[model samples]
Target chain A: MNWKTVLRLVSVDVKSGRLIRGQRLRRYRERRLFQYLLYGGACVLGIVIGLGAGTLYTAVPDPDLRTLFYEGARLLFLSFPIMVLIYSLIFTMMSQIQRMGVRSSIQLPYWLPITWEEHTLASTLAHLIGVPLASIILFGSAIATVSIYLEAVPLAILTIFALVASAFLASTTTEIFRVLQARLIGAVYKSSGRAAVWVRFLGSLLFLIAFYVAWFALTSGGGSIALIEMVASAQQAGWFVPYVWLGMALASFMNGLLAQTIIFSLASLLFILVLFYVAVKLNAKFGLYEPPAITVSRGAYVPKVGFLGRLGFSSLEAAVIRKDFKAFTRRRELMYVFIMPLVFILMPLMQYSGIYGTPVTPGSSRFLSAWILLAPGAIMAVMLGTIIIGEEGGSVWLFFSSPITARSLVKCKYAFVIIFSCIVTLVCGAIGILIARPSPDIAVVLLIESMLLIFALGAVSLGTGIKGADFTEVPRPRMVRPLTVLVYGLLCLVLALAIFSPLLLHAVAMEYIPLPVSLPKLDLYVAISISAVIALVVTFVFYKIALKNAEEFLIKAEI
Target chain B: MILGLIKPDSGSVNVVCTKAEDDPVAVKRQVGYVPESPRLYDFLTGLEYLDFVGDIYGLDASEKKARIEEYLEAMELEGREGDMISSYSQGMKQKITLISAFLHKPKLLLLDEPLSSLDPRSARIVKDLLRKLTAQGITTIMSTHVLEIAQAMCDRIAIMYEGRLLALGNMKELRQKARLPGSDLEDIFLKLTGTEDVREVVEALLK
Candidate 1:
């Protein structure tokens, strides 16, 4: 391996996102100081944390309590390696799945004079460098410093070594999985033809959902401690599994089983080497694989007006709407717009589902029902509306050159956002009703509030999107200007509050306010009517703003 | 200015006899523009894209069907039209863009590097089609870097330099203006642009 070349590749991978932001720099050397400063900062923070932990351990006063503390710390130290390995594996896998949703990740520089082993090793290291390495440094420093106070310096040194080895093992395993996924996905695309589109979309969606579910399960209330305990037990129970061998070795070392410790340590090192070799081999085999052309329609072409036309849209308006729908469904990057709403729904649903041991109280259930019924659709509206025009990216010139009026463009985009958001709301609302079983009146109120938010926020986002659409698609597409998106989000928040405040006030008054004087109850209809009126006014005002922006957008095609 | 894609600094613009400010949509309806480096929606199949273009131009379903089919067959993209444009070759994408421009049969064609990425036969077909359409009173304003193409295909050529018209005329008038009586368009163009002495630059590079 050319160590220099591998190091260069690793540096490129590490600083790729930074490079996009620091394009004004003529060379990497110009940013070298900043990189060093960041490294120094992390080291300082880690050392500070280490000193603090050591001091905390030394301060345990009572003899019995100190003994308990020492035992708990020893147990934690024994399991730390396995815990790091699990975290590294989960994070690397999540990053890989996220890359699959984008058009391109940090691509391997194939034209460079680098061996497959070097490239694979560099990638493995780079993927681990971000969160995994930083965390290891911090924890390792803490462990070392605390060990001095506990008078177990040699064991702490061994545990730190095991931790590093476990992290490397996890990274190498992730590298193999990444290569295999590329080959498998390429094979599926080549053979599946039209079904490949949905297959890829649904597959990415599944992985994304799994990542979120795993994350929620692991991080929620005492989940991390529970996970470590489970892993510790599994390490003892499943001694044959190679993954937990590092932790087992440390545990054995603490228990004075020198033979077992030496054997497991040696085996773990060998396993890591084997994993690295397998990852390199897989990369060599499938690193250059390209996905085949996806034929969406193979039959003779038929030019009939689609369902959008039947919904009373003009041919021009219907065409734009249909194209936007196809864009969202077919484009990998745009698929996130669909996936995000599902994720929003899934998060709250998981809490209420009793799957993660989260107790669903009456208040929690009410919040879940309201959130599941309202938030996804409203969020989808804001997201979709803000991105609809900018999602055109380069092809927006088609709208500019075509005989499309600004009114038609706004109507088409607004209609699409409303339609798609409504679909999401209905699906999510159905799920919410089935799960939460809210009363009919509450459900109706939730649905109405959702509709109002969607309409008003959709227009608000549309106006903002048109005003600040950024069509640059290098590195990755930034659909809207950052400032514009911020404004859009803020505007949506204000408008959503305005539209929901009446209902919100009624609920708060009923729930919290004492009624010694017998205050008249504000009827649900009255609140909803007020909200609907506010939404209608906001929609009318923002629709005009959106129309004006569209006119300027069509004429100002320089972007 | 013509398509209202960008506004003029200090002057009015009209296209197909419609003032852009007065009725930009009307002007757009009459004009079919193929931009330089045309950015197509890669997610859509070529057929779907063409259908979209047809619908935008208010073409009836039957007309859209006939025209898209004819264009696909003529461009030798019949079987591949169902594939997403993302998977298409550059030449194939150019053909699709050309087809979309022609689908509506607009009164005027504004083409920028119209023959770029085209196979020779496809280029010949486009050349012949433009000639026929021109004869039928459909004006075509094509921009090209290939001087030979400009010399052969154009009745009147306008040479632009730094956003200013340096020369406007037929071959005879261009030759007369450049004072290169027997020289071709390339020679006249190089001379006009003051970049005719490229041998010195080439020698400097070699050295």
Candidate 2:
């Protein structure tokens, strides 16, 4: 074994890691105002939340119950480090699925004069920053929380060891996920519409269930009944639930069972090493293998398509929407973004389902209905702006050089966003009304507001995308910088308030209409009509502004 | 600019009767461009990408379907529509781009290093295709560093160095201008581009 070469490769990984961080810091530093605003806001918010949490804790009057709750909170806090490790595995695996493996644009090292082993090792080592960083933060926080209620240094040491083992396991399994992601994409991407749709839906549904399960376990915010139920589910997770051993070790430490703690700790270490060996073997078999060229004959099953769209896109604009829709559908990873808003909207329905036997009203929370509309509207808007340009990857030059006008280009993307967002909002709105049964006037007002939100959201998202678009990207890099998201969000918030202002006035005016406006239904109809007119006017104005800005920006766009 | 994509800081571009600045949309419609390494939408199927371009060109339903299928078959891509363009080989992408550029049947065609990914047979097919299009009165301008291909294929050649045109002419005119009658295109290009003694560089490399 060339230990020297391995060490050299390791050093290069360290240097490259440092270089990447340095560049990021430098870029952030370049935008000093935005960076300062973001960091400053976060720090202030942290301080405020900490003070409030402290106040809430001390304000509890029931001493016995409070003590019991303190123990529960300590146990929960102690579970965080272990939870972090598990999450690291889950999230890393999901993101790796987003990657195209050896065919990835980032695979520049494939062309370098390096051995497969060295390349894999260096690339793997380079990513060591993420797991370690998460481990340290969670370890420190867990220790701090537990230290407040108990004094167990030995338990702390065991917890640290378990964390290291978990991190090691997570890091090594990176290539495993890469292979899984690649194979999954290959199978689904090659299939026709029906197969693709099923795979996309199934993938998103699994993640949603997993997300809910994890969230329920961590929060159990519903009550002791929910907590007991979560514990039962955890017990039912079967024999391979080794992750629970971390908690078991902590529980043993809390109860002063040294033997069990020692055993669990040793077993965890052993498991980590076994996983490392398996991971290395998997990496050799999969990650180290070079990707073959895309052979024309391999794809010998071209699917026929309709000449015209189902949504009546007869002109040049249809082409843009068709391409965008196709790209969006083909990349199943992106489907989660599309599915997630509906998931959120369905939350109350799921919560109030017959299983709970809870009394539910569909339109009970007008604010929630508004939130449902805005959340999905926001996602679609940001997607429209960022995705339309970003998904173009390198191929965007085709559109840029085409006979298509900038106005029409912007219009086409916005039209898709409008169509997609409106359909989803209406469906969710109907469901919300059916379940919650809010007043007809409020629902009508919300429908109008939903349309306004779509227009405003698109404008904000497109503007942000135009500012920071890097066209030569695939699944394009974050089109809106974090600061840009905040800025655009604030901008959209203003637009929302402005658009809803007229509707709000109408809603408040319901209580004290003059004698001449005696009929309640007539007044409600008048209010809805006025608001609808206002929404129409606002949408037209914002759409024009957004189009003008986008046209100017695109005309000057370098790539 | 004649490219229609980038605006010229000074001067103007005129393609056919219309100045590019006057109506860039019209100029874009008139011109067919095939960039050397065109970025393709990886998420669309090969057939979908064709239909997309055909729709933009405003081709009728039957015409679009017929032409798209014909070209896909011509390019041996008829069977590849099930897969996303993301899964397509570089040559396949090049073929599709070429087909899109040709499908429009514009007044002018601009192709840049069009045969980079093609095998010999496909390259020959492209040469014949270009000849056919040019014969159909569609003015085709191709930029390639391959001297033999440029000499053999192009009706007129433009040699550019550092973003400035060094020479523009027919094969005979360029030969006369370079004072290298009966000499190869490589020599003429080298003379025009101001590169010195390539034989020495070749010798050094061999050594």
Candidate 3:
């Protein structure tokens, strides 16, 4: 087989896909930023830990520092495989699915002169090329640092082999999962019925629950003990048990055992080759194919009664809300936005109930409740605003030229935001009350806090909505990066600090002034009322600006 | 009576003295719309999408089942229906869009670019579909850039370039009034619309 030609063709195809997705330029910038952040964070963390260790425990000598470095390197090496496997698999599959969809790929072998096996092999190799290289570089650097401290050649060699095996294992597992998922989806589609869809969803949920339970059980003390012993026994038998075997082989090699080093390297290489072969065969059989066809019935239009219907919502608005609610209920990604707030509310309540060792204080309860309500409120606002504007995509002209005015459109979007935020906040607040069993005063405080956070989130949403660019045409999934998340988190923190500054100042004064004099209830009530009024006014002002910004965006888009 | 986005209140929009506003959803079911720019869920294949629209229009289960294969073949997209709509080329998407609008045989078929991106083969298929429907006495309103297609295909043509209808008439009368004897439809269209600049641009690109 002409491997070079296959490689060239693969490269050309990869490059073309990258160009189509506008990824070549964006990916370059992303890579540079990622490297900068990773290295920078690592250096800062290392320095902080080193300094803390030096100050707190000075009994350890230079040998201890060397040992700590080796341990850190080993942990990083062990974890790298799993991280690369999950991230590379998910990112590659999602990006490919979004870009060309499953149908296009299914036609690839038929259109091209190459066999399915060859095409699958080339594509798999092309997909793994980036992540594999990254993994190697990361582990290679870590090994080099360790070598400088310990002068161990065998450790460096073994580390490189282990990482390569990890990358292969990750890539293969990902391919298998993708194939399985596509086939399952296809089967569900062929059997068209409401029952089929529900069965599929329930099956997936059950599988997820089972997997998590198994994982928890496996990691628990009883399971871990048995598993560890089993692995130790396997390592003594031979060098094929992966983690334990590799650990033993590497330890032997580090002690200058040449035979073990050579044997370990050969076994690792054979494992990767065999895995790749099997993965290629699987891809040929099932990988390149159309997604399963599922029939969707037009949802019955039930007239929404009560508060939402009375909000002057038009038919289109009601339809959109109903449709979105149904869609989000089915979507796992959106479920997280709902789930996170519940976690925020429940975690503190759990602590208060003495489920976790700590007894929660009143101040802690207030902080937790406020955070639980605020974080999710901000996320929901951002998500709704971004998607509403962005979903227009290449079809903005239809919306613009429609008889519907921009004002009505904006109003509908805001109505969705407000309604969703209120629902989430109220549910979370109810949970908080159930847990804390706070006095009526605390209930009132919770109400005020909820209102304040909602208004603030409304303003934040408008601001971000205006500034954020729509990437609808781009193939990559919409993801808020860790840094952007941190920034948003910091903004929330600053706002919370500003609101509770009076309480903080009161606490400080109590330490100095020596009196147990609490602020009047009336004064606290007035303060909260003023803050709510100011937040509402700001929200209104931002809403106006956001509306204008949206109009300008629509005009500019001209889609 | 249902009113607001689907129907307007304070007035009767009647079909044979049965006010459509009395059952706006039923009215909407009978009114087919091909949006200016159609967006289908990329996750669905062409046949599945057509079946969905058919089901929504309250077609019976047996009818929907029968119609899926019929429309797919009618649209000249029978074999390709298994492929996702997102995988279809521009012309293919246009064909599916047309098929979706016509699935339930609506009384009023609103079409935008019913033939725009189609190749001659697919365009002819769509033209035949339009002819077959209108022969069954269903009214069809469609927009097109190909004046020749309109002249040949449409009984009545509405010339709308910039959100305004410049002319509305039968083919022969409009062509005759333009004072171009024996000139084909393209020449007459160029003269009426004064799109000489566009012709020049096309000529330059060809050159």
Residues A1-559 of candidate 2 have per-residue lDDT tens digits of 3556656766654443232222353444344454245345544554454345445556778998667756755555446445656556655555444443114533434565555555555545444444454444445444544443345445556655655556556656665555555555455534534365456557756764666555533443363345444543462353256655665666666678889877766776677656556655555555533322222233333433445455555468877777777656545445655656666665544555543455554433554665565566655665666555555655667776777776877777778777777877787778777755667866766777677667666765765665655543332233334566677667767776766666555655553323344333436556556656665765676667667766665455455
Ranking by lDDT: 1, 2, 3
- Arrange candidates by TM-score, highest first: which order? 1, 2, 3
Recovered fraction of real interface contacts per model: 0.92, 0.52, 0.02
DockQ of candidate 3 (2 decimals): 0.08
lDDT agreement with native, every candidate: 0.84, 0.63, 0.56
Question: How do these models rank on DockQ, best leading?
Answer: 1, 2, 3
Which ten residues in a row are the worst by lDDT in model 2 chain A?
A: A288-297
**Candidate 1, DockQ to 2 decimals?**
0.73
Cα-lDDT of candidate 3:
0.56
Select the stronger candidate by lDDT from 1 and 2. Answer: 1
Chain B, model 2, TM-score against the native? 0.94
Candidate 1 CA-lDDT value: 0.84
**lDDT of each residue in B1-207, candidate 1, tens digit only:** 778766677888877788887788999999989999998988888898999999999999998999999999999998898888877988999999999999999999999999999999999999999999999999999999999999999999999877889899999999999999999999999999888889999999999
Q: Give the DockQ (2 decimals) of all models.
A: 0.73, 0.37, 0.08
Question: lDDT, candidate 1, residue B32?
Answer: 89
Question: What's chain A's TM-score in each predicted model?
Answer: 0.88, 0.73, 0.72
Deviation from truth (RMSD, Å), model 1: 3.7
